[model samples]
Target: MANLDIKIREAELADLELILAFISEKSEFDGVPHLLEATADKLKQTLLFVESPLVRVLLAEVGDTAVGFAMFYASYSSLLAQPCLWLDDLFLQSHFRGMGVGTALLKSLARIAESTNCGRMEWTVNTGNVPGIAFYQKQGARILENIRLCRIDGDAINLLAGQ
Candidate 1:
């Protein structure tokens, strides 16, 4: 691929639709499109319009064409006594992969983590995404072994809440 001028910037309100599209595409790429239930309205309420939004998004563009996005949130590491940047999602279009757009996005995130005095940046990779794992490893991330992610939502959340 040619040397593309990849621009990474924080998402603006005008880019709401673009962000939603990227989220959908990322979900499809992860082979779990059926689990996606995010709507524009929900995103607006929970992420965009909130006074203190927990999640933030960075959009990657090659000129006028948006090629990818990275979504993340801050979490505290009690053990380290510092904040951690939890990368919730990072997705680049198939054509944009290997063109350094992903690397640029990640570099931007690392800057954010550094500026905010984060102890570390953390994310999980799906076992099936071999290429993604390799890419992350190339960026100096190590995959932790013998750790499983657990989740509870929907009815389970309600049941646990004693509803």
Candidate 2:
């Protein structure tokens, strides 16, 4: 599928709804639909209305059909003493899989990181998602065995704010 008609472009404010739909689809495909809390309004506020936006979205299309998207943000790497790019989400439609859509999205991100002088690009995959893990590995990404992801959200986040 190297000759696939995949074109990756930076998302714009007009793509809010499309991006939200893609996110929902990704959550459902990953068997976590109940965890999807994104909506067009919220996406507009955070992804478009903010003064200093925290995220950048890249959309992949094939002849006007939206196939996938990658959402990322900038971060700092203390050890490297340089900027890093954190890929929060990368997803493609089921039919688009194995057609190099994912690879194109990742490669575009790598180029963006390089252009911006980012030291590293990072993202996490679900442990049970074997295919996803394998894809990353095949792309020369190392799966760190010792590091674990932690987060606070929902009521816990509110409680922490109150304290």
Candidate 3:
């Protein structure tokens, strides 16, 4: 189709399979879990949240294929009295790296946040992820020297919810 183009749009239920493929492929490359034990139904549940104003997935497409995606969730800042977008995940396949797709995705997200009056946009990268660090620096994003990120994932959250 000559009219087909590379564009960004909200991810949908139909994108479940393709998005999972990207994550699994990246996980394999990063020596992490390639499969998350996720099913289409489970993905649908997740999509419900993402489709809401509180969360969103922006798909980067080329032709009929999705080459990259950025998953973000909205957070509130009590001090700023404004919503903040916490970028939960950003990924582009190796073949597409250095082509400015990642930057484009991030800039798009920033623009969205700005449009919505959100106070902050944030995410973290592993210290060993050199390219990521460099890119963030080049974008004028600050790298806090002494700060550390803490996480509680998997069964820990369930355990807390049980209380």
For every candidate, C-alpha RMSD to the true structure in Å? 1.0, 1.3, 3.9
| TM-score of each predicted structure versus truth | 0.97, 0.94, 0.82
How would you encode candidate 1's per-residue C-alpha lDDT over 16-78 as one tens digit per residue? 899999999999999889999988988998774589997999999999899999999999999
C-alpha lDDT of all candidate models, in order: 0.93, 0.91, 0.78
Pairs with backbone N, CA or C atoms under 3 Å apart (clashes), candidate 1: none
Note the residue pairs that clash in candidate 3.
none
lDDT (tens digit, per residue) of candidate 2 on 1-163: 6578889999988888899999999899889999988988888877744788878899999989888999999999999999999999999988888789999999999999999999999999999989899989988899999999999999999999995
Tell me how far candidate 3 lies from the true structure as C-alpha RMSD in angstroms.
3.9
Q: Who wins the lDDT comparison?
A: 1
Clashes of each: 0, 0, 0
lDDT of 3: 0.78
lDDT of 1: 0.93
Work out candidate 2's RMSD over C-alphas: 1.3
Clashes of 3: 0
lDDT of 1 at 136: 96
- Over 1-163, each residue of candidate 3 has an lDDT whose tens digit, in order, gives 1333567788877777887777676676556774456566566676644445445789887667788999887888999999998887888887777777777788889998899899988888878888988988887788887888877877898998894
